[model samples]
Target: MDDPVRAFLEANHGAIMTTLKKDGSPHVARVVIGLVEGKLWSSGTRKRVRTAHVRRDPRATLCVLSEDNPWAWLGLETTVTILEGPEAVDQNLALYRALAGEPEGLDEYRRAMTAEERLVYEFTIHKAYGMH
Candidate 1:
């Protein structure tokens, strides 16, 4: 991610991410976008359709609308890497705070976070487009 895309992502922009289902259909969802170590990242539960889709196929796409101009947007053709373990929960926290801001329910959030199986997906951009 770079420039306007990065800036848009850093702001309160929502992302529409898509993954391929086993039947070769697209499953789309609004997701939290984050930058970890300067790379774009997203997350979801392992039991979810999107995560399962990613486990089967790494290909994905993320689209962010420019906050400055509603008509302008950026889309990325991306591949994902799944990271799991205790650190994955921590990664989820970082990604969550990136979009949702710091929550007042930190302890509750941590407890809830610890209960789920998480996949921290790092996006590798293969192509990008800025739609005017």
Candidate 2:
């Protein structure tokens, strides 16, 4: 990644993620995504349709526009792996902190995650496009 691209990704920008539905259609969702340790990942639950689609097909795409300039953006075509174990919780929280700063009400979120399910989808970038 170039300097400008890396800076843009570091900012708090909204990301759009696309996954293939059961019928082979694209299912797009607005998500919080972060580039961590040279890879991209998104945190959420196992109950979402996005998770289901990813489970069925690992191929996905993520796009994020520059928070500084909307015209500038990053696009990535990736293969996703759903980490579904105890480590998912801490890993997802680490990604979340990197993207959204430290959570104020972490206890509530932890309870909810425990009640529901917290999963992290790690993305391996196969192809990417962005400006330097």
Best by TM-score: 2
RMSD in angstroms, all models?
A: 2.0, 2.0
Clashes of each: 0, 0
lDDT of each: 0.80, 0.80
- TM-score, cand. 2 vs. native: 0.86
lDDT of 1 by residue, 1-132 (tens): 557666656663568999999999999999877776677888778788888889999999988766677887778899988888888878888877766778778888877777877768898998888773
Error of 2 at 22 (Å): 2.1
Candidate 1 residue pairs that clash: none
| lDDT, residue 46, model 2 | 85
Superposed on all Cα atoms, model 1 deviates from the true structure by an RMSD in Å of 2.0
lDDT, candidate 2, 1-132, per-residue tens: 666656666774578999999899999999887877866678878899999999889999988766677577788888899987778767877887887778778987666666778888888877779652
